[model samples]
Target: MELGLEVLGFLLTALVMIIEGIAVVMSRRPMHSILFLFLLLLTAAALFIELDAVVLALAELLIYNGGITILLTLAASIEPEEIRAPRIKPDIILPLVAAVILVFMISTYKFGNVSNFSYTSLGTFILSGYGILLLVVMVMSIAAALSATYMISKEDVGI
Candidate 1:
C-alpha cells in the first residue's frame, strides 16, 4: 500500500540522515566531512520530496547541495598545510554533548504525519506570498560562492 511505502521512505531517510551526521562529525579530513554534509543535504531533500514539498526539495538541491557544498569543497582544498595538520589531542567532548542533546530532542518531540499539512498550499505560499525567501537563499548562495572564490584567489599569492 501507499502508506507502507511512505513509512519505509521515512525510515530510510532518517537512517541516512543519522549515518550522514555521524560520518560528517567523525571524519578527520575536511573534504570527507564536506562530502558527508553533502549527503546529509541530499537526504534532507529526499525528505522534502516525501512530504510533497517539491519546491523546497529543488531549492535544497540547487542552493545547498549544489552551491554551498561546492563552496565548502573548494574552501577545504585551499586550506594551508598547518590548517590541515592533525590535532595533537582530539576533542570529543563537544561532539558527545551535541549528540546527547540531539537524541534528547528527538526523543521528546512528537512527529506529525506529513498528511497533516497541505503541500500544495505551502508550495503556493512559497511561490507567491514568501517568494522573497527563495530569492534571499539564491543571493546568499551567490555571495558564498563569490566570497570563497575571492578568498581562495587572494590566499594563493599569500595576500
Candidate 2:
C-alpha cells in the first residue's frame, strides 16, 4: 500500500508537470504561462519530497516557484495586453517530441523509490549573498503584484 501510494504521487506529479509544459507552449498569454510554470515548480517540489529529497524540494520551492515565478509574473504584467497576445508559430513538432519523451521516462524509469542520496548532508551549505538578494526581490515583486491586483480589483482606473 505504501509503495502504491508513492507510485500514485509520482504519477500525479508527472501529470501536473506535463500539463505545465504543454501550457507553457500552448498558452497565448504570458501571465497564464507563468502561472503554469509556478504550478510546475510546485509539483516538482512535491515530487522531490516524496522521493526523500527534502533538501532539493525546499530549494525548488524557494528558487523556482518563489523567486523565479514572481519575476516571470512581474515581467508579464509589464505589458499585460501586449504580452497576452503572442504570435504563435504554426506547425511545430512539440507534441510529438513531448509524447515520445514522456513515454520513455515513464517506461524506462522507476518511480516511487527512495532516493539514493542523503538530503541532510546537502543542507549544510549556506545560501550566498546573491541568493539572499534574489529571494528578497522575489518577495517584493510578489507583494507588489498582490497589492496591484487588489487595487485594480477594488478601484479601477480608467485608462
Candidate 3:
C-alpha cells in the first residue's frame, strides 16, 4: 500500500511538472510564463521531496521559486503599462480545483514514515565545502536584480 501510494504521488507530481513546463513555454505573456515557471519549480521540489531529497527540495524552493521567479516577475513588470499586452482574466477556477485535488492527495499520503535523513550533516557539508560558491551565486543574483531595476528606472527618467 505504501509503495502504491508513493508511485501514485510520483506520477501526479510528474504530470503536473510536465504540464506546467509546457505552460511556461507556451504562455504568451511574460508574467504568465513566469507564473507557470514558478509552478514548474514547485512541482520539481515536490518531486525531490518524494524522492527523499529534502535538502534538494528546500534548495529548489529557495533558489528557483523564491529568488529567480521573483526576479523574473520584477523584470517583466518593468515593461511600460502602455506598451504591455492587455490583461486577460485568469482562470481562477481551474487553479483552485487543481489545488484542492493536490491537497486531497497530500492529505491521504502518509508522511510520518520518512526515512532518517540527517539535515544537519548535509548543512554542514554545504557550508563547509561549497559555502563560497553559494555566496557568490547569491551575490550575483542580487546584483543582477539591482542592475535591472536601475536600468528600468533610468529609462523612466529619460537617462
Candidate 4:
C-alpha cells in the first residue's frame, strides 16, 4: 500500500537521522564529527520530506549541510595535525549505539500521515524568504569560519 511504503521510507530516514546524530556527537575526531553531522542534516532533510515540509527540508539541507558543514570542514582543515585528539573511547561508542537502536525501535510505530509539499506551494514569491535565509546562513557560516580560524591561530609563546 502507498501509505505503508511511505511510512516505511519515513522510518528508515528517521533511523538514519538518529544514528548519524549519535555518530556526530560520539566521534572524537572533530573532522569526523563534522562529516557525520553533515550526514545527520541530510537525513534530517529526508525525514522532513517524508513529513511534506519541503520548504523546511530544503532549508535544512542547504543551510546545515550546504553551508555550515562546509564552513566547519574548512575550519577543521586548518587545525594542526599534531594537536588533533586521538580516537574516542569505546565505552562511549557502545552506549551511543544502544541509544540509537532504541530510538529507531521506538520511532517505527505508525503516526499521523504527514504528507504535504511546502516548497511547491510557495511559487516565485519564495524568493523573499529564500533570499533572507540564504543571506543569514552565509553570514553565520562566515562568522563561524573566522572564529575557528582565530582560535587555531592563537597561541602563547614559550617563555
Best by TM-score: 3
Report the lDDT tens digits of candidate 1 across residue range 45-148.
Answer: 77776666756878999999899899888878888533454332224533543354345334433466355556657767778987898999899989988986
For TM-score, candidate 1 versus 4, the one ahead is 1
CA lDDT, candidate 2, residue 6:
54
Residues 45-122 of candidate 2: C-alpha lDDT, one tens digit per residue: 666666677667778988897898897787768874753454443234335434543453355344555468754444
Q: All candidates' TM-scores? A: 0.57, 0.53, 0.67, 0.54
lDDT of each: 0.69, 0.65, 0.73, 0.67
What tens digits encode model 3's per-residue C-alpha lDDT throughout 31-124? 8778878777777777777777777878998999899999889878987543445243337523853584467346644566565665658768
What are the runs in model 1 whose C-alpha is more than 4 Å off? 1-3, 81-159
lDDT of 4 by residue, 27-128 (tens): 777887886776677667666655667668778978888888998898889876545564655455545644554454346424554454325457565566
What order do you get sorting by lDDT, best first?
A: 3, 1, 4, 2
lDDT of 1: 0.69
Off by over 4 Å in 4: 1-3, 81-159
- In the predicted model 1, the residue pairs found to clash are none
